[model samples]
Structure formats: C-alpha cells, structure tokens
Target: MVSLEVVHASNARLKELGPGLVALFVGATSGIGEYTAKAFVHNAISPRVYIVGRNQDAANRIIKECETANKDGKVEFIKADVSELSEVDRVCKEIAKKEKHLNLIFQTQGNLNLRGRDESSEGLDRKMALNYYSRMRFISNLLPLLRTATTTPPHFSRSVSVLGSGGGTALDTADLDLKNTFTGSRCAGHTITMNDLMTTEFAQRESGITFSHCAPGAVKTNLARELPFWARTATKVLYQLITPLTVGQDETGARQLFMATSGIYPPSKPVEGAASASGVSPDKTIEVTKGASGSVGDGGYNLTWKGGVTNGKMLPEYRQNGVSKTVWEHTMNVFARVEKINQERGNVK
Candidate 1:
C-alpha cells in the first residue's frame, strides 16, 4: 500500500509537469468523483476541469468549492445523464468543442443496488450502462483530445475508472450483456469483467494513453443510497464499525490524484528512461507496476485501492481465451446500434 504521505508528495509535484492541465470528471456530482475533482483543483496548476453528471445542485456546490480552492482553476459543471450513450456523446461533444487536449479523465459513476436489471431507455441494464457502456462511450468520444495531450510521465493522458477491477470472474461470453440472466449480482459481475476487458483492449490499441480500472476500496461514499432500506441501514452500521479501517474521502482523493499523475502506471510506448521525468530523480522514482497485460508499462492497469496491482487471477486466462477482443467487438456493436437508433430518433446529432 502506498502511504498517504507519498501520495501527497507525488501530487504536490503536479505543477512541476507544467500548467493549464485539462481534465474531465464524469459523475463528479458526488462521492469519489467529487472528492477527486476537488483534489485536482487544489493541486493542479491552472487546470481547466469539467464536472459532468446529472445533479446540478450538487455540481454547483462542488464547482463553488473548487473555485474557492483554486481561484485560477476553472471548474465548469456540465449537466448530463451519462447513463445514456447519446447523452454521453453530447457531453463529449461539448467538451471537445471547448478543449484542444485533455490531460486526465477520472470516472466514478455507478450505483450500489440490489434491484434486478433496471433497463435504461436505450435497452441497457441501468447499472451496466452506468458502470460500463457509458464510460466506454465517454472514453471513445473524447479519445481524440486525450491523444493530443503531449506530455511526459506523471502527467500524460490517462483514464481511470473507479469500479471493480481485479474482482471480476471469467465472463460468460455468450451473455456478455447479461440480457437473459439479469440478476443484480450477475449484472455487477459482467460489468466488472467487461471493464477489465475494455481497459486491456484500449491500452493495447491506444499506445500513448494509459487506461486503468481501479477498486475504490472501503471509502465512505453515498453509493448505497439506492439500496433497500434494510441494506442501507446495514451499510451505515457497518460503516460506523469500520470507520477506523476506511480511508477518508480527502485522502482517497489524494491517492486517486496520485494514480492519475504517477509514473508507476506508464503508457505502453514509454519514453526511454521516463521515470526520471516524473519530477523525481531516477533513484527516488517510484517503480512501475505491471499493466493488465502482464507487461511493464503496457498502458493498462487493474489497481487496488492502495495503489498496487490487483490479484486478478482470471485475467491471464481471459487473455489466453481472447475475451478482450470479443468484449470489444460486442461493445462497439452495441455503440453503433445505439448511435444509429438515437440518430433516427433525433436524440443525438
């Protein structure tokens, strides 16, 4: 586990990489996303940040606090129901129009619920949509700007998704979307596995940008608001009991900022001896962890909450079985189908 002090030290150097860092925070209205947005605003130098989510009130509050934290940083709230792919595209289009390049994309958009298979208007299970499909859509749409971020280690273009990373099981490829077997648990498992696959695939294809699927660990967030009353009560009680063990929201934000800027998860095509460029001497530079493809600096990482690699025992098997390619093809097909339908409906341009 990386210590909070180390995380803070690394983040404190974000300014050394240069200023005018552009970032997009999907689902920053509350919880981890909000905290990380605040951290970015507090630490980054003259950052232009976008806060995208459904809650304007919450976004407004966050934006106000961010502005107070860094008067030079510009934080804009973009109202978006990102669970819908069309909306994700629209949000991405808005950002693309405004920014020439993006330095980081941090996403923590998901709901914790036991409800079974709630479908979105687009015919996707709402939980899966929020956790998987919508995130991929945002990344795909904004990838052009991400690719344009020409920077050195610790401040390159990167996308970090806070979800179940190493905690996925082998997928049932026949039911990748879990349309037929749509239990809440199955939906969660499928989305988790799909995130891993998608991250791996994107890292392999997009050589310069880094992709990470990370477990947020035991951070106290309001993710369980959608749970049943009994479940919500239980979580509250459990949270109190485990208060000493859980990382504080502020510290979690610092750690997440560390993941976003640290050279430990370098891009696939790393600059020769790039560790020295991360605002630290070579001897003092943090070691680079292996990516999801079992290669050092391969650009995809499944990270633990403490900034270590996850013990994804199923990842190797999934790779050998070519599941990443299968998942990518299926996801792209779904995106194409949804885009065509939304265009016909005049819901998206």
Candidate 2:
C-alpha cells in the first residue's frame, strides 16, 4: 500500500508533468472534491480546472482559493443541480464547448439522504441520481474529449468516481432503477454495483482512459446532513469519538491526487481483450495494482481510501450472461427518456 507521505510527495511534484492540463470536478462545492481541486491547482502548472455544483457562495470561495494557489492556473465554477439529468447534460455541454481535451474528471456528487426516499423532478431517486446516474452522464458525455486527451500529448485522461468501490453486489436486473428495490441496505448495494459496473463497461469500451471507482471510506464531511435526526446525532457523536481515525480533508485530497496520476493503475492501451490489456508496466514511482477486471494495469480499478485496491467481492453475476451490457442498456434507456422529455419541452437537443 502507498503511504500518505508518498502520496503527498507525488502530488507536490505534479508541476513537472507540464502545463495546460484540464480538469473538471463535479460536486466540488465542499468536502473531498473541494480539497482535491485546491490541491490540484497548488501542484499543477497552469492547469485549467472547472468546479461544478449548485452553491454560488461555496464556488466563489473555492475559486478564490484555487486562484490564489496558482496565479497562472484557470479555475472556474459551474452552477448546476446535478440531481437532474437535464442539468448534467447542460453542464457537460458547457465543458465540451470550452475544452478540447480533459486530463482528469473527478466526481463525488452525492449525500447519505438519511431522511428517506427523495425523488428528483426528473423522476429519479435524488441520491441515486446524484451518486450514480449523473456521474455516468458526465463520464459518457465527456468521453470524446477524454479519448482525445489520451491520443493527444498527455496520452491519458482519468475518470475517477468517489463512492462505494469495495461494495459491488448482485444487481436486481428486474428493477435497475430501484423502483421496487429501495430498502436502506439494498439502496447502498444497488448504488455501489451501478458505480463499479458502469465504470467497468466504460473502461472496456475506452481502452485509452483510466476509470476508477474509489471508496473514500469515511472522511469528516457534511455528506450525512440528510440523515434523520437521531441518526445524524449518533453520527456526530461517533465522529467525535473516532477523531484520530477519521481522514482529514488534507490527506484525502493528496490521496485522491495520487489515484489520478500515479502509475498504480496504468492508463490503458489495447492488447487483445481489455481485461488482459496490461500494456506498459508501471513506472518505478508507485506500485501497480491489478484492476477489478483482472488486468494487471488496465480495466476499471476499485480503490480504497488508503491507496490500495479494495478487498471486497465483485458479484459473480456481473460476469455472467452479459450483465454489463444489460446495465448499460438500462442506463441509456433512462437517459433517452429524459432526453426525449427535454426535447419535447424545447429545453434540450
């Protein structure tokens, strides 16, 4: 496992990687995304960073800090509520209009939603939309530019989703949208499976990019605000009790940066089938970890907060009978329905 000090050291040396690197961070209004954005600006050389979220005040503060961190870097805020598919598409269009290639895309747009099942106006469970659907939309829409980045000078672009990585489980194919399978434990399982499996499909389809589903463990953030009162109170007490064990924002930022750049999960290049597409060997700086798809260097990576491959079961069903294909079809159907509605209302194209 990579140590925190080494992660920090690697992040500090990111300037040597050259300039003009572009990054788009979703759900960066606060918490882990915010810290990661600031760290990127501080280390990168003249990078262009986009912070997307709904809070104007939080955006302003983050932008100002990022600007101060690196005067030459470009830091911009995009205001949008990511729980809605329409907003996700709009924000992605804005990024596409501005950037020709992206070096990194980091997403963590979700909360615990302990209050209960809350659905968005777009007819999706709000938490699932933010955590799973919206993230996939960003990855799907920005894929062309990400591929361009790999073919371009940098030769790689990263897509990292900060969520439950070590938690893939058997998906209820009958109800992919959780319409009928929305219990607390089941909700967590469904979301985790969706996150990892979708990333896996994307990695297989786009061999040039690195797709990572990272479980950021438990950092001390406001992500549990939506929890019911008693649960929230209990969490607060537990957080204070486990002060020494909790990951601070600073450490979390550096560790995420390592995942973005380190050769542990080498960027892919084709070699027959994708799961075995372990092309170039890892560089000397970091130890290489095999991907969730069984490739030494390629395929979708399931990472943990401690800079290690997560030790958890990837449901065997994911590999049987074209499960990945089924999940993609369902996700696309959901997107198509949203797009059709938006087009009919004269709001989208």
Candidate 3:
C-alpha cells in the first residue's frame, strides 16, 4: 500500500508540471467529490475545471475555495440534477460545446440512497440510475471529449468513479433493476457489479482512457446522511464503533488525487491508437499499484480504498458465466431504450 505521505508528494508534483488541463467534477457539491476537486485545484497547474451538482451555494463555496487555494485554477460550477439521463446528456452537450478535449473527469455523482429505491421521472430506480446509468451516461456522452482532451504523455487521461470497487455479490441478471425482487443490499451489490463489469469492458475497448472504480472503504462524509433516520443513525453508530478504519476527509482527498494523476493507470501502447505516454511520471520513484487487470500499467483498475486490487471471489462468477459482457450489453441496451423513448417523446433535451 502506498503511504499517505507518498500520495501527497505525488499530488504536489502535478503543480510543477504546468497546466493546460480541463477537469469535470460531477456530484462535487459535497463529500468525497468536493474534497477531491479541491485537492486537485490546490495541486494542479492552472487547470480549468467544471464542478457539476444541484446546489449552487455548495458549488459557489467550492469554487471560491478553489480560487483561494490556486490562484490560476479556473473553477466553474454548473448545476444539474444528474440523476436523470436527460440532464446528464444536457450537461455533456454543454461541455462539448465549450471544450473540444477534456483531460480529466473525476466523477463521484451518487448518493447512498438508503431511503430505498426511489424512482425518478425517468422510470428507473433513482439511486441505481444515479450510481450506474447516470454516471455511464456522462461518460458515453463525453467520450469524444476525453479522447480530444489527452494532451501530454505521462498525464494521459483519467475517469475515476468513487464507489464500491472490490466487493461483489450474486447479481440477479433477471432483475437488473431489482423490480420483482428489491432489497437495499441487493441493489448496492448490483450497482457494484455493474460498475466493475462496465469499467472492465471499457478498459479493453478503449485503452486511451485510464478508468477506475474504487471502494473508498469507510470515509467521513455527508453520504452517510443520505440514509433514512434509522439507517443514518445505525451508520453513525457503526462509524463510531469502527473509528480506526474510517479515513479522514483530507487523507481520502489525497488518495483520490493520487488515483487521478499518478502514473499507475496510463493508457496502452500505440496499437491502442495512443502514443504510450512517456516522461517523468509521478510514482515512478516508488512502487505504484498495477491496474485492475492485475498487470502492470494497464489502463483499467479496480482497487480497494488503499490502492490495492482485490476483485473478491464473487466477481469471477461474472467472468466465467460471461456475466461481465452480459452487463455491458444490458447497460448499453438500457441507454438505447431510454434515449430512444425520450427522443420519441420529444424529451431529448
């Protein structure tokens, strides 16, 4: 495991690299997303960043802090309810119009949704949609920009989704939505599996993108408050019971910044159509954890909170039964059906 000191050192190195980078922060109004965004601004070189969320006040506060932290960092806040696919599409289009290439996308756009599976106007479970579909929608819509965004070697591009990345459970393929059978635990597992499988498939197909879905273990953040009164109280009690394991906000931010910029997740060779970035890569001086595929320097990674890959026993069932590909197909199908219906209803946005 990489030490926090090393992580902080790597982040600080990005400052001297000079900046012509663009980053989009979704669901950064609070929690890990906010912390990570601020950390990036504090260390990044004169980067232009877009922070997206529903709360203007939180966005303004974050932007102001980023300005104070890094005088040259251009921080802009765009408000949107990203739980809806329409809104996700709209935000992507807006960004596409302004920037031709997007260098980094640090997405933490999800809530715990412990109140249970609520349905949005889009008819999908609101929590699942936010965690899986909405996040993927943002990526799919902005992939062109990500490709255009890659500027230098060593830096390449990165998309880090902060969620459960190392745990897996029996994914009921019959009920991807958990409609006929729904439980809070089951829903969480399904999304984790979806995240894992999607990122896995994406890594193979798009080697230019440095992709990761990380489980942040336990962290002190506002996400705990999203649970219902009883559930929230239970979580707090659990946190108190396991205080030693819980990561501090600043440390979590440093680790996240390491994931976003460290050399550990560089793109593949030119056969993958990207000139394998070469230069003074941070973490080059230290042993960096390999990509999620278990090989050194692969583009995709699924890591624990401590930057180690542990794909739990249950995930192999997904690969053995071709469940990962099954999920890739199912997710694409869902987006297709939803977009087609939305377009037919003149709700394309």
Candidate 4:
C-alpha cells in the first residue's frame, strides 16, 4: 500500500510534469470530484480545468475557491445532469470545441441508492448511468483529443473512473442491462464488472491512453443523499463509529490526484524513464504496477483505494469469454440509440 506521504510527495511535484495541463472533472460539484479538482488547481501551473455537474450553486462556490487558490489556473463550470447520455454528448462537444487536447478525465460521479433500477428517460438504470455509462461516453467522445495529446513527447492522457474496482462479481452477458434481474445489489455488481471489462477493452484498443478503474475505499461524502432519512442517519452513525478507519475526503482527493498525475501507471509502451518523470528521485520512484490484463504497464489498471494493483474475482472467466468486447459493443449500441433519439428531438444539431 502506498503511503499518504508518498502520495503527497508525488503530487507536490506535479509542476515538473508541465504547465497548462487540461483536465475535466465530472460531478465535481461535490464529494471526491470536488476535492480532487481543488487539489489539481493547487498543484498545477496555469491548468485549464473544466468542472461538470448538475449543481450550479456548488459549482459557483467551488469555482470561486479554486480561482482564488490559483490565480494562474482556470476553472470553468459546465452545468449538466450527466445521468442522461444526451447531456453528456453536449458537454463533450462543448469541451472538444474549446480544447485541442485533454490531459486527464477524472470521473467520480455516482449514487448509492438502495432503491432498485430507476430507469432514465433514455431507458437505462439511472444509478448505472451515473456510475458507468456516462463516464464511458465521456471517454469515448473525448478519445480523439486524448490521442492528439499522445502524438507529442512525454505523451500523457489518462482517464480515471472512481468506482468499484477489484470488487466485481460474475457478469451475466445475456442480460447486461439487467432489465429482468434488477436488484440494487445486482445492478451494482453488473456496473462494477462492466467497468473492469471496459477499462481492459479500452486499453487493448487504445494503446496510447491510460485507463484506470479504482475503488476509493470508504470516504465520507454525500453519495448517499438519495437514501431515506433513516438510512442516511444509520449510515452517518456507522461511519462515525468507523471514523478512525475511513479515509478522509482531503486525503482521498490527494491520493486520487497522485494517481492521476503519477507515472507509476504508464501505457503499454511508455517513453523511457516515464516511471521517474514525476520528479521523484530513484529512491522515491514507484515501480510500474501491473494493469488489469496482468501485464505490467499495459495501459489499463484496476486500483484499490491505496493505489495498489488488484484484480476482480470474475475478471479471468469473463476475459476468457471475451466479455469485454460484448460490453463495448453493448455500450456503443446504447450510445447510438440515444444519439438517434436526441437528434430526433433536436437535442443535437
């Protein structure tokens, strides 16, 4: 397990990486995304970071704080309810129009609702949409820009999904959408496994970009806001009892920022000495960790909260069955259907 001090050391040296780095923080209005966005602003030199979420009030507050913290850095808020794929497309188009390349895509949008399978107007589970589909859509829409970033030396483009990595269960390919077996737990499992497969699939296909799916352990956040008052109260009580063990929000943010900027997790064929590019000396440099494919530095990683490598129980079986391809195909079909509907309604020009 990587210590918080090492995480801080790596983040402290982000300035050596480069200036004017571009990052997009989905669901940054609150929780882990909010904290990490601020960390980026604090560390990066003249970074142009985009904050995407549904809360305008929170966005305004965060923008003010970030701008005040770093006069050289730019933080813009693009408000949208990302649970819908249409909005995701619009947001991505806006960013694509404004920027030539994106250095990082940090996604931490999710919900913890015990209620089962609340379908969006676009015909997918809302929780799953937030946790999985929208994040993948953002990556897909912006991959061209990411590839553009990689054409240069010291090439750096990464997509980090803050989700249940290494916690996936068996996947039921016949019902990837879980329309018939839609329990809260089952939906969670399906999304978790799908994310694992999605990262591996993207890694294999896109060799230049890095993909990571990480579980941020247990950090106190408003993720459970949708739960009933009683449940929320009970959750608060439980967390209070385990406060000593839970990771703090600021530490979580710092750790995630380290993962985002550190070269310890490089692509399949990284530039020489990429692992030491974080400006850390040889003694402090972290060796490249194995990716989800069990290959060292293979462009895709499944990370625990401490930024260590981990593998899900069902990954081997699902990989043998070539389920990652099915997940990718299913995701594309969903996006195509949604875009067609969006065009029909004049949601896209």
On a 0 to 100 scale, what is the lDDT of residue 116 in model 3?
A: 62
Model 1 C-alpha RMSD vs. true structure (Å) is 2.2
lDDT ranking, high to low: 4, 1, 2, 3
lDDT of 4: 0.85
What C-alpha lDDT do the candidate models reach, one value each? 0.83, 0.80, 0.78, 0.85
lDDT of 2 by residue, 129-186 (tens): 8888999999989988988887666465789999878776677899988887676667
Stretch of 10 with least lDDT, candidate 4: 275-284
The 10 consecutive residues of candidate 2 with the worst lDDT sum are 271-280
Each model's number of backbone clashes? 0, 0, 1, 0
Off by over 4 Å in 1: 151-155, 271-285
List residue ranges in candidate 4 displaced over 4 A: 271-285
User: Can you give the TM-score per candidate against the true fold?
Assistant: 0.94, 0.92, 0.92, 0.95
lDDT of 1 by residue, 129-170 (tens): 999999998899888888777443343688989887888766
Quality of model 1 by C-alpha lDDT:
0.83
In model 3, the Cα lDDT at residue 349 comes to 74
Query: Model 2 off-target regions past 4 Å?
Result: 228-231, 270-285
Residue 320 CA displacement from its true place in model 4, Å: 2.2
